[model samples]
Target: MGDTRGISGIGDADDIGDMGGIGDAGQVGDTGLSDGPGQAGDAGGADDAARAEDAGRADGSSGGETLGGRDALLARAVRLRESGHREEARTLLLTLSERCPDDAEVAYQTAWVHDTLGLEAEALPHYVRAIQLPGLSDDDRRGALLGLGSTYRILGKYPEAVATLRDASAEYPDDGALRAFLAMALYNTGRSRDAMEILLHQLATTSQDPEIARYRPAIEHYATDLDATV
Candidate 1:
């Protein structure tokens, strides 16, 4: 089998400073003047309010900065990978992941780049993180599942490979690539008969070759009953 790496709200707060002690009837030391809405206490309260507003703005800006250019960067990384500049793509994706650590797309793309570079071990954690994290697009989710399962198989984790690929195949029952990978994993786990059934079924359904097309009915029949005498 070919080892192909398939890669694809907030709220505000309120002022709790007592509004310059509006209810306080007592005066300061001996000045005989009660604190009011615009006194020193009130000024301090205003300063606090201003500081809070400034903090809120800073937080908003910081959030924007975190993900501001992430899409552009991700696209550039993808372009680099597609163009066969895998090393450069890996570096760019690494930087993007660091900047957008919680970003699902960043995590997925990072894993894919590592896979293309033959760094399956390094790709493992990113794949796990991307799958666990939410907001992943449907296409990327499919790719991530296939990549994770294939990587597990490559690493000799046959059981994990089978389980992951089985789940993926269930989720995407019509995905031939997933079935192909799952069949390989099944063979690795000594289920060669089951594996052949899946491969034969896939070939019968998806192949366009004239020879296979001519024999499609036999292939489909044998796929389910490999030992059938008739």
Candidate 2:
């Protein structure tokens, strides 16, 4: 539901399909992955905001190190982002990332905010740091992977996108969103057949449309062997 303007070489939202269900929420199949040419970097929507609010409300009584009410600041940033005050959120997150350079959550949120603002180039390092630093939750790690790879693609870094997406797909095999983005990256890299194969396989197994369902077996049969004879 965010601004979905297209970048050069990347299709608009209608062309790329909605990627709101990529990571942290659940499997891509569970969310009904859509098809398209572009990838949405907004991985988790309300779930992210809710989680940040919950964390902010925590008393931090646990033995974990509290960097001067880091949770509260992170929650504030999430609120700003969810509320569509992205410029304010980005500025705050930049400061937070500097103050809490070692905080995975801060780095990840910083990257996400940057991506939402169409600053994918600025987001790269933060996404990498979030993934590299300890303390990132498993769900967030998955989201970061998808975000990083999709960012790479948007920036015209095709090889990097392919590599990052492939690894992400391998790690989260059941995530159809990963495969969908991976397919896009593959197509950009001139592997149209491979991309179509991935899309076909996903459609065959996941689609609920009556026509696709009726031809599921045939689609599956041709998924990998697109050039096969009858």
The C-alpha TM-scores of every prediction are 0.71, 0.71
Off by over 4 Å in 2: 1-65
Q: Superposing every Cα of model 1 onto the true structure, what RMSD results?
A: 16.8
- The residue pairs that clash in candidate 2, if any, are 16-38
Candidate 1 residue runs with Cα over 4 Å from true position? 1-60, 63-65
Judging by TM-score against the true structure, name the best candidate. 2
Tens-digit lDDT string for candidate 1 (1-230): 12344444001111112112211222111111222322322223223223333333443533212332344345545655666767666776776676677888889888988998889999988989889999788877888898899999999999999999999999999889999999999999999999999999999998999999999999999899888884
How many residue pairs collide in each prediction? 0, 1
lDDT of 2 by residue, 40-134 (tens): 23323333333333433453322112432344345545656766778766766776686679988888888988998888999999989988999
Instruction: Indicate the worst ten consecutive residues by lDDT in candidate 2.
Output: 1-10
